[model samples]
Each structure stands twice: as C-alpha cells, then as structure tokens.
Target: MEAGLTERSDEKGEEEYVLLDLDAVMEHVSIRPDTPYVLTGLDTLNPMLIIDGKVKLIGEYEETIGTCLVFSENEAPVLHKETGPSDANLFSGRCIVDPNQVPSKEVKPVARLQKVLKFRLLLDGVDDAQQDHPSTEGNASNQSTATQN
Candidate 1:
C-alpha cells in the first residue's frame, strides 16, 4: 500500500485497506468522549501495529451485522492495580477497562478463525402470511425483515 498522504491510495491496490492520517480517520469516524470503539481488521499486517497510542479495544474482523461491524479476540490480561471489585466481592457492579497488552512490536497476531459470538433475534408471533411492511427503495438488501403481530 502507498503512504498515508497519497490522494488515491484508497482507490489503488489493497483498496479495502488504506493508510490515513489521524485527522482523516477521525473525520470518517465520529467519536464521542469516553466511548470505546472496537476497531477491527488491525490484524491484517497493517502499519498501525507499531504505532504509539493507547488502545482501549482491538479485535479481528468477524462479519457485518445490521449496520455494525463485528470482531473477535481473546480476553486481554488485566492491568496492574485493576480498579474492579476484589476477588472477595461476588457481585460486581460493572466491568472496568483495566487490561494490559504486550507492546505491538512484541506481539504478532495470528490469523485464525476465532470462537466468535453468534447472535440472533427471537421475536414471537411473527407470521409472513399477514405481512405488509414499509421499506425504502434504496439499499433494500441492507434492511431487515420487519415483523408485525
């Protein structure tokens, strides 16, 4: 892949992956304060492997669902002096982000099929015979089958 500053890098070879400046990436992804974004496709030997930054979450790409991108990775090791409940505390309030990961240079991700999460929606009383749903013309395949009771 060409360098990050190239104007047509996204259109060139390895089109699915394009190097972009931090500002350009931020423009495409609107991030709110303190919200953690699970970035997928980082395991594809991208140059970002050795970049200096704090990583809240990272994963390998699994598949796309609804408008969301899915990913999977093993649980990260707990950071030193974790803020969560003590082992003595059985009931937990909420999980905190206090995990440690080896430096990217030291860790080379292996390409393999992860024991990924499979999800499904269970809706009762859904029948196709009485179906009449409103759907937009464009991007019909992306839309879900609307159910009526």
Candidate 2:
C-alpha cells in the first residue's frame, strides 16, 4: 500500500512485494460483457475449436430457407444445418426456466483485467486529389482500359 509497491503474504508466511502501475489497472473494460469477443493468438482455421463453446450459451434458433441459424451468447447468429424429421430432439420443444430456479446472487468475474489496451488509427500519406484535375495524353497515369481482347 506504500507508494507503488503492493505487499502480500504468501501461504508460507513469506512477505512478497510486487511493483505495479495502479493507474493502468482497469476493473471495467470498454467492451460489452454480454457480447462474445474473439481473442485468440493461435489458429482460427479450425473455427469449430473457437465456435463450439457458443452452442452451450442461452439462445434461440431460427430456420431459414436452406439452413437454421442458432444464436450465441449475445444473440449473435451462427449458421447450423436444419434439423430434419428422424432426428430425436427435432420437435422436442423450447427450454423453460422457472423463476424460482434463478440464482439470487450475481457472480462477478474473478479474472483481473490488469492491462488496458488502447489502439489508434495512424493513416500516413492520405492526401486528397484536386477537383477537376487535368490529364495529358502522354501521362503515364492515364492508361487506357481497352484490352487486347
């Protein structure tokens, strides 16, 4: 608690002092919690690896012309194959929850979002062209679109 050093006692009764910039510690992020945010540093090609967990979230499904769209965490739609007749749970029905079954206490996330990330768009050399610019016949930039065909 003194200055910038945070002190904490370990299970072994040993004192550990860690240095941290407290101002950069963010409890609230700019993004929405209900919305699903994709953040993986690894391969996204096997999208099922990244997408499979979404089917467990609370959402509804819609049947389109060819495919059925199932929604994810934030009501984000995910395309799925239509459930045909012979399927066991095809017409089982919607899931219903009783009001008394809902938990009373709200669970706050235990994960600490220590680092605050900020990004700026730095576009270099974006100049506007003059209106009604004149072009010369011999100008290299004035190439004809006519092809050999």
Candidate 3:
C-alpha cells in the first residue's frame, strides 16, 4: 500500500503504485502535535488490510513517531513494540515496501486498497464508523461499492 507519494515510478516494468507524500498526507489529515496516526495496511498483505485510520497517544520514540511506511519483503517480520503499560503492539503486516529493506533508496508506501480508502476518508475529514460514533461516510466500502454498484 502506498502512503508517502502522490505518484508512482516506472522501474523494472513493475506497475507504479500510488503513493502520497507523507507531509501532504499529514497536512491533509490535519495531524496535530504529538498525535500518532495508526494506519492499518502495514499489518497485512491484503489490499484492504487497513481497517481504519486513527490518531492515538503513544510513548515518545526516538523516531519521528508519525505514520511510518514499512516496505514489504517476501516475508516480513511482525512489528512488536511495547510503548507502555497494558499496551502490547504487534503488527504482522506486509506492505509493498520491503520490511527488511534499510531504504538505501528513498521510497514510499503505495496506495493499497486500505490506504486509498483511509486517505480519501481522511482527506474528507472522517474516520471509520466503528471507531467514531459520529458517522459521516466513514465506510471504506462506500466508494468501492458506489463504483461497483
């Protein structure tokens, strides 16, 4: 899933994936200070792996601590981090970017189904219905359904 650039590259005859720049995505989402945006697609290989887009409070990390774009490999490792008490985070997600990749070259996450849905919703300033009680087209399937139906 692409999440860091708005366009794709044509390399090795590989289909370019849709990726939005991180800064643009954050600005579009209006991420506030110290807010951690939890994007779901990084945990699964499926196109629609991301269940929703959310912002949460997390312990400070040395990294920038925003939405990180994890690349995928043939086999990606689960992301397990312990931020605080009672919080055991485990992400067995796979993305287009290689997980083991040290990013010798700069790349971004492509727009997988979940990332696209989440980004569109975020651009419109809405969250998934399951998390947000106030519903305003929070359904990811809304667009896909509308297009199909």
Candidate 4:
C-alpha cells in the first residue's frame, strides 16, 4: 500500500493538519493483538493515522519512533489489557502508537517521508471459517441425505 497526505481539523477543530495514510501502513505491515512495534520516520507534528478517510492522531512522538500496539477486531472486549480505560478509541484493527519518537528539528514541510514499521502475528485463537466448513463433496452428500429424509 502507498502512503498519502491529507488535511484534517486539529484537536480543538480550530486548525487543519496533515493526515497520514494508516490503511496503507496496515496493508504493508502485519497487525496482531497485544504486539508492540516501532514505526519510524513519521511526521512528528502531524503524526496521525487515516482510517476510512478519517484522521486520528496516533500519539505524540519525539524523533519519529513510536511504540505501537496492534489489536485484532475480535479483541475489542478485552482491549483493556493493551490500552488503558479509554472507551473513546478508534477500532478496526487498532494500532496504538506510543508517544516517544521526538523529532530532532522543528516541524516543517517534508519533501518525502519513508517509514519502516515492524509487526507480529498473534494467531492465538484465530480460525479460518472456510477451512472449518465442509468441502463440496460433503455438502453434496449432506444435501442428498436431506432430500432423501
């Protein structure tokens, strides 16, 4: 996935800021529940993620390195283990970027920004629905049996 830039309203909805492409990031990286990762080379001032075209601030960073946590869509109920008590959070395979990466210089317009993010896979109770279902032969046999009955 490729990254793109967009403008978004600030915290107080008073100013507009740049939004980072998060869907692209997720597509490029693997996201698992309860995993920590380091996303480098992000725009510190406008360090936000874009989901469904909506802008969301990941967190404040110092030097472009932020510790992030990826959570599965199915783990919403037990998300407290990864994040604190914050019901108002963005879902859809959550990636929580820690406020650490501090920029060396002040915020400025970057010609190009490339980031390398590391992610892990957490297949604890994951199951493939297609694999669990019966095969074509089994389905045909079952249909025949049902018709006979």
Candidate 5:
C-alpha cells in the first residue's frame, strides 16, 4: 500500500488532499486430477474518517466509497495446455522447472486465482464548506464524554 498528499496554494489559502493505492496478488495451483475451482465474493471495508486541526461540523454528512478489482488470469486450463511456447515468450527472465516432480494425491482443486489493484482518492475541498461554519465551543468537552463501547 502507498499513500501521499498534495498541497496547492490559492488566493484564499493552501489546500491539501490525500490519495491511497494498494496492490495484491492471490493464487492457488491444483495438483489433483478432474477437480476444478471457481472464484467469487470480493469485498472491501468502508474508509474510516480522521479529523485534525480545529474544525467543527454544523451538520451531518455521508460519503460514498468506490472500489475496483483487476485480474491477470481469471480461469484455469488443462494442465497440458497451461504452458507453451507463447508462455515462454511472455517470460521476462529465465524459466526453471523440475522435470521429475510427482503430483500429490492429497492436493485439492484450486478455486481462486486473482490479482487486485485498487486506489482511493479523497475529493478535493471537502472541508472548505465546513470552514465557513462557527466552531462548536464545547466540542472538546463533548468528545471526552463519548464512551468507547
């Protein structure tokens, strides 16, 4: 995962923004015959909100989240057809494999092989409107009384 923020100056003042990027790879290879697998159910958690500096909310608001998933290989083919000259051509470096390897009978079918690439961008100037509102005088005291259930 990677995160960074950008800052720019306008006639009013300086503004800051944040961006997050994440990449992941998941794979499973089957060693048993006549067993096939399927991949399903991809999900993500909502983004948590963090506030800094002296800012006060005069009203409540909701934010919508977005996500994306990318795959390199979405399906599994027959073992014999899994590799070929085209595969060798696609390799960027040397390829090595054991010639006398034996398949394990206990191996189960692979159900999922996936690659996920994601990014989250916080919209610009979200707090600008709030800056116009008057700060809550007792916000600090109220925050201290909220219990952590």
Candidate 6:
C-alpha cells in the first residue's frame, strides 16, 4: 500500500492499479520503456538531417513554425522535388514540431530557442521577402516578429 496513483477499484476484491514509480517496484514489475526520440547534435545551432523528408526531434526548446535551419550539402539527405535553393549551402529549412510529443522537462528550453531563432529569420532576409511580395502587402515588420520570439 505504498503511495501511488490508481484507478477506482472494482468489486469481487479486485484492485487494478498502475505502478506510479516503477523504480519502487522493479523487483515485482517488468515494464519495457519506449525509445526516446533524441535529436542529434542538440548542442549545435541546427542539428538534424532530413531523412525521408521528415525529421523528428526530442527538443530542449520550443521550435517556431517559420524558424529554419541551414545544413551543409553533406549533412542533409538528397531530396526529390522542384528545388528552389541548393542544399549545398542549405538555404534554410523551416522547423515543424508536434506540440503533443514534447517532453515534460523541455517546455521552457523550447520557448527560449524559439525566441533566438527569430533573429535567424531576419538575417535570412525572410523579412524582406515578405515585404517585397505583393501577396503580403500590408504586414508588420518581420524583424519585429523575429525579435518578439
């Protein structure tokens, strides 16, 4: 009867419960943990390769929708599409994260990274692209948006 979390017990003397702390009951319980989706080279600024046109990350920070990462030619896998820019200089790849998959310990770090990544958007002339495009005619300064992140 150690302290733990459990669902309501049933009749007929049956008590079904999940062991909250497996470490406390390892001797009696066997549970296989899931493989964590760890991002490679998290220490570096942009650390991941787009394999199969998709990249997953276990992040220490929140990634912005439009914030991008540039990879050298050797870093990224070959892509099959009408290419606008060469992966050789890695003309910036935008980030897309599934918020539901975020780890419990990394919420704050992701938020901070989101802020820093804003500057990268500005430096890449994305701000100018938006301004120059007639489609985005009356929008706020992209520089402000990046700095606000």
Q: Which predicted model would earn the best TM-score?
A: 3
Report the error of model 5 at residue 9, Å. 46
Candidate 4, lDDT over the whole model = 0.29
Candidate 1: C-alpha lDDT:
0.29
The sequence of per-residue lDDT tens digits that candidate 1 reaches over residues 52-83 is 22321122233332232222234354434435
Where model 5 places Cα greater than 4 Å from the true spot, the runs are 1-124, 143-149
Report each candidate's C-alpha RMSD, comma-separated, in the order given.
Answer: 21.4, 26.2, 19.3, 26.1, 21.2, 27.8
Question: Please, what are the lDDT tens digits per residue for candidate 5 over residues 15-117?
Answer: 4221221211012221232222221111222232212332211221222143222112223322232245564475534454445655322222212212221
Cα lDDT tens digits, model 4, 6-57, are 3234767633222222344465454343333332224332222222222222
* lDDT for position 34 in model 2: 43
Candidate 6's displacement at residue 140, Å, is 32
Q: Which of candidates 3 and 6 reaches a greater TM-score?
A: 3
lDDT of 3: 0.32
* Clash number by candidate, in order: 0, 0, 18, 7, 0, 5
lDDT of each: 0.29, 0.24, 0.32, 0.29, 0.26, 0.26
What is candidate 1's CA lDDT for residue 39?
28
TM-score of each: 0.17, 0.16, 0.18, 0.16, 0.15, 0.15
Runs off by more than 4 Å, candidate 4: 1-21, 38-44, 48-149
Candidate 5 has its poorest 10 consecutive residues by lDDT at 140-149
lDDT of 2 at 87: 60
A best-first ranking of the candidates according to their TM-score comes to 3, 1, 4, 2, 5, 6
State the weakest 10-residue window (summed lDDT) of model 2.
42-51
Candidate 2 lDDT, 1-149, residue by residue in tens: 12222334577884421111112212322322243422222121111101122311111122223321111122223333434546676434444334545334322221122222222221244331221233211211211111110
- Flag regions of model 3 displaced more than 4 Å: 1-20, 45-149
Question: 34-104 in candidate 3: lDDT tens per residue?
Answer: 44333333222211212234532111112222333334333334443444454343433323444775545
- Candidate 6 lDDT by residue in tens digits, 15-106: 42111111223353332342222223334443321112222211123344553222112223333343456656443564443455533321
Sliding window of 10 residues with minimal summed lDDT for model 1: 139-148
